[model samples]
Target chain A: MESWRDNRFVFWLLSLPGTFWISLFFIVPLSVLWIYSFGEKTGITDVAITWTGQNYGRVIEPVYLQIMWKSLWVSAVSTLICLLLAYPIAFAICFAPDRWKPILLLITILPFWINLLIRTYALLAVFRTNGYVNKAIGWLWNGIDWLFGGQHPFQPLELLYNNGSVIAGLVYVYLPFMVLPLYATVERLDKSYLEASLDLGASQLRTLLSVTVPLTMPGIVSGVILVFIPSLGAFLTPALLGGANAIMIGNVIETQFKSANDWPFGAALSFVLIYATFGILALRWAITARSKGVEF
Target chain B: MAAVLWNRTPQGPLEYSRRLWLKLLLFATFFFLYSPIAVLIAFSFNTSKRNITWQGFTLNNYVVAWNNPDLLDAFTNSLIIAFCSTLVSTLIGGMVGLQLWRFRFPGKTAYEAFMALPIVIPEISMGVALMAFFIRIGWLTSDVGWPLNLGPIIVAHIAFSFPFVSIVVRSRMVGFNVQLEEASRDLGANQWQTFRYVLVPFMKPGLVAGALLAFTLSLDDFVITYFTSGPGSVTFPVKVYSLVRRGVTPDINAASTVLIAITVIATVLAMKLQAPTKAAKG
Candidate 1:
């Protein structure tokens, strides 16, 4: 009894700091999410408290619907690209010699901890007209001119502010997240099952279809969800590298608050995003869990 | 069966093709990752009217960028804010993690999940909400009310970063053997002494890691800081963004290269030091 009392005391004491922060910062803000979504806009910036679904109604308007559709399409493409890129890298690391595995994983993850803003700017330098690729092209043109041809040559494509740039930035930023979980999932997979398929005289392609893909479904699903969720909300990369036209839902939400001076609408937009992301994530989790049970 | 996408194995003839494919894939990936970063680093040293055109190799931009007084001031402000917030949140999170890890309580799971939610939620919402809250209560400006002003900015940073600290620290606490605490008490060491000499030492790595994450997040933040921070409270990233949006200049490139170098070095050092602690999700 005495020991249990001491345990209780220690537990309660340790929990105090986390509990305080969660209540004061996190829980309060999240709870206020629904409130903000329904509140009324008074002055341009201020959201007056009055319950209504008017904001949700406006979310269905064609212009806003277009923005939402674009956001969805971009996120879907980004997720698909991230999955294609991450899967093999994850497979290689999982099967690599144990001594080499850690280093490779570290290399894969190294770029992630660097500030995203800086990384995005780095891409900016590369994509700019007079940047390194252009300079190298100029050098090559001069070389060709000196050797055989007469005059100077072609120009930089100016890849900035394009969909390609935005996709590049997202893939760069989120690649490691996709890789890490896939590696974790792949490493734990048993190899004996593959050997059994081979013994049955099935082709590698057949075994992969019948066995490996089925096992790694969770990783692929989770990876898709992880990449998709954040891409939907990205503001800075789209704002900087994506230029004006490729505006995301996050940029739309920001406009509501800053430029549009429509706080209630901004709040509504945020609530919509949060709901959509969480709702999709939850559905995926449920499906995965159900599959796990069936597999068991 | 090589499930290139569907299976994890290569067929007899496809094995060679697959190995060649992996090599190409790895090279392409590494190129995709490093080319942009290399461009930024290279341009920092370029001497030209145009940052894009290489007139000659020089350190002119670095010299000018570093010498700027406002940039220096912004760096100092960011450092101070990050350091303070990291320390405070680490301590707070450490204690909370210890509690949750050690005992059962009502609402524990809900709280744990709630604490973890900040990581996945959009930072913009958290930043704006905190800014709104501070304004409504008159905690924003010294002239309006409150005996002291750490300013609304610091409060906002502390609030947003609080979740990161707790989640990281709590996960660290989860892996430590609870038997140590029981053994310490059995040996006659009191609770405080056991925590001071043993439990804290064990928890130190996670706490420090959590602190590092908090510090970096605070330093790199722009959207959050823009809303919460007052005049004279610009973070380095926010300053860089404004500078970038205005125009492309060699000075910004120099500044960016230095910042990237710091982050890269810090990340490598942390990874090296903590390699053996049973790697967990990032």
Candidate 2:
């Protein structure tokens, strides 16, 4: 009985620090944000606590709507591209020889450790006009000129400061996020199923489609979510690579908090984004649950 | 019969093409991932300050980065924040991991979920929410509120990194053998002695790994720091970001190359430590 009491005391002592820090810094702040969303902005740093839904209604304006749509589609395309690129890499790593598997996985996650800003800067240097890429292209052009007796100088394509570059940056940054989770799932797959499919007269492609894809669907879904969420809220990539025209919802939220002096509107915008993201997650869960024939 | 049928089937053109396609895809994916970083490192050596066009090679860029006072200050600030947060969070996280692993209590599931929540949510949400909470409660500014500086930034770092440490330590504890603890206790060792002599040695990998992860995450953080930090507290990533915005320079490239070197070395060490632990488990 005395030992049981001591154990309880020890448990409380152990749990206090983490619970206190998280409650103070994370949970309270989130609740505070939820409360602020319903208040009205009175001044630059002050807000009135008159409960109003006007801030949320502003989210439907055409400009905001257009930005939201662009953010969604751009993120979707990046997620798709990352999925396509990562699937094979994940497969290769999973099936690699035992001695090499860890090294291969390590290489895939190495880029993730590098600063995102630095990586974007690298992309910027590579894709800049008269940069390394264009210089190489110009060299090739000179070769073509020498071959064909044509003397037109090569012109650099407009690669940076556009939607395409933004998407490219997003895909590069998020590819490891996609690959790691997919590798986790694919590596753990039972190999006998592949053997059974092959033995049943299925070709490689047929077996991959019928066996591998379905089994790795959960990974694909998770990879999509992981890539998509960060891409949707990406401010740095679009700001650095997309120039002035390719602003995202994240840029708007950032401006509101930093320079726009409209905290209420920013809070409302954030809540909208949070709701949409959570709603999608909940919906996906429901669909997955239903598909698995498990009722809740 | 199956052997005869397998011998009769020859590798077809389609199979050959498919194999070639997969090989090309894998090659392209690796090239895409690696070439930019390689180019970045190479250009850091170029003497030119303007474009990435070939210039005379020199190590002057590294010297420039090393000489910049603002960059050095930012680097110092980042180190301080990373160290403090890593220390506090590791201590807290070790305890949390122990409690979660060795004890059963009411609301354990809910507590676990709460621990993992910060990791799953978008960083922007966490950043803005904290900003809102800080400002609304009069903690951000000194005029009408509390004086804010590195305090909020450190708190935010500790908040986010706490989960990472807890998760890693919990996984390590899950693999730990309970017999060692019981044996040590049976031999008349006290709780502190058992923890020091037996548990600490056993949990060293997880503790080191968790601390390293927390430190790295604290160092790499920009968005959360940007929101929570006040003037004069800009971290290294924040400084690099502002520099990138100002213009492209070989000095920035040099700085990034240094950053990349540190992170790569750390990651390799982490993998080395983690590999043995994982292998032993299986």
Candidate 3:
């Protein structure tokens, strides 16, 4: 079949608008940010491109380093939790009765479409000091005291404004990102392989560990990257839930831009994140390529 | 036949327990996913202002939210931004998708990779980058007239959203019969007429779905909008964020419920439009 390359003018006309828009708005801005990463702040409102590494140098200072470390730790923990929770749910959905699959899938995706801020706000309502969680716990405590005739009053547990709450918020918001990729991979998995393993005398647990997990490695990798990257750069979750002590790298970058007026430093920090993202993607690509080569 | 016979056999105790456990886990996960939103929705009608405890049902929160001028203005800004971004992104992205589907070109892989960049990078990076770009170009400064205001925010949204539209439209073009276009041309139609009459109808479902997706993305966006928007162009999410920082109130809950309802309706409509195509394909 002849391609649209035969009509070069029409092809250019079709492609040029999007290309030009992305170049001006997306690529040019990113390039500007890249240049500013090596710049220095000259005054209260002026940033001079002095080609300094001091901005990146400042990133390794103990204070900023600690925040970066904490961000990685928090993102890793939340991503791990998302994986553990999502795997079973994805597996269940893949194996669900045909008629129920759509409904279950929709339920999984609906929260994804909901606004992230609204969802985080909902978490606030659930985990506040006098929130529903404490209310229920307090009620249970009263019931126990009534039975035992205790004199002490019930104390509401402090569930919000901490690292734990921030982690919980990340896991909540990014769970669907983990689930959808897993569901796609698991749904495409061959059932006959599982049956063959069972017939070959492998226990279910053994088969899952040795066979199913390996087969779903691509999905696992994608899910982890999706959840981990967002959690690492999460601003609202930490701002709303983390209070004072749980500041992540994202919040710090935001501070540089908004209050500190350190555009150069913020641009440097943003580049660090962008580089990290590229590194992870490259690692995934290399792994996938190696695995594909092994198939031959 | 063997598979049917195996399915008819009774499950052992271990298998039965495993199945039960799986079902329970699925139930618990769903509950975890949904219970917070359910609580938020329920409390939107709470009579008390604090929203710390349940109170008698009232519609006053919604009434208050409706009457708040700042909230209304922010919401109007969001709608205007979403509409403009959606329309432009869809048209530009649709053209890109069509070109990608119908042609082979040099450096195609690089072009495709560049298109995916906005999606792959963290949004904060994009937000700050755009902000910096606007400032560097003097578009975001107080003195600039044309490129100032909501222009940068709208541009940022279009940059992020058009890639998604391209993806959807391209996928919709898969397995599309090119013969229809040939037949239309043979019927004495010009290139413009063929596209308008033949191609547009085939691409309608995808276009609508992509538009809905873009609209929701723009409306729900906070980070990009936060950085790109000037003081006069505060969006709904930015307004809500400030309100949240001040303190949680039932009216915020009321506002949130309305936003959620809009998003859910848009998503469901997009899904409904997508469902028929999948069914037909299958």
DockQ by candidate, in order: 0.39, 0.46, 0.58
Residue-level lDDT of model 3, residues B1-282, one tens digit each, is 443354556654223223656778888888988999998999899998888778799999999999998998888888889999999999988988888887887888898998889999899999999998888787677655432477888999999999999988988887578999999999999999998999999999999999999999999999999999887888899999999888889998899999999999999999999998888888
C-alpha DockQ for predicted model 2:
0.46
Which one is best on lDDT?
3
Best by TM-score: 3
Off by over 4 Å in 1: A1-8, A30-33, A133-155, A293-296, B1-18, B139-151, B279-282
Q: Give candidate 3's whole-model lDDT.
A: 0.88
Clashing pairs in 3: none
- Models ranked on TM-score: 3, 2, 1
Q: Which run of 10 residues does model 2 chain A get worst, by summed lDDT?
A: A287-296
C-alpha lDDT of all candidate models, in order? 0.74, 0.83, 0.88
Off by over 4 Å in 3: A1-4, A145-152, A293-296, B1-9, B12-18, B143-148
Candidate 2 lDDT by residue in tens digits, B1-282: 443354345644222222445557777877778899998898899987784566888999999999998898788888889888999989998888877887876677888988987886778878999988877676676443222366778889999998988888888888888888999999999998998999888888998888888888898888898888766677888899888888888888898898888777777787778878888888
Q: Tens digit of lDDT per residue, candidate 1, span A1-296?
A: 12325567666666666667667665665556557778887785457678888998888889899989988988888888999889888877776667878888888887887677788788777777776766777688878887877655665667777777788788887898798878777777687787789788888789778987788788878778778888888888899888887888888888886678777777788878878877987888698888882221
* Alpha-carbon shift of residue B269 in model 1 (angstroms): 2.9
| Better structure of 1 and 3 per TM-score | 3
lDDT of 3 at A167: 97
TM-score of decoy 3: 0.95
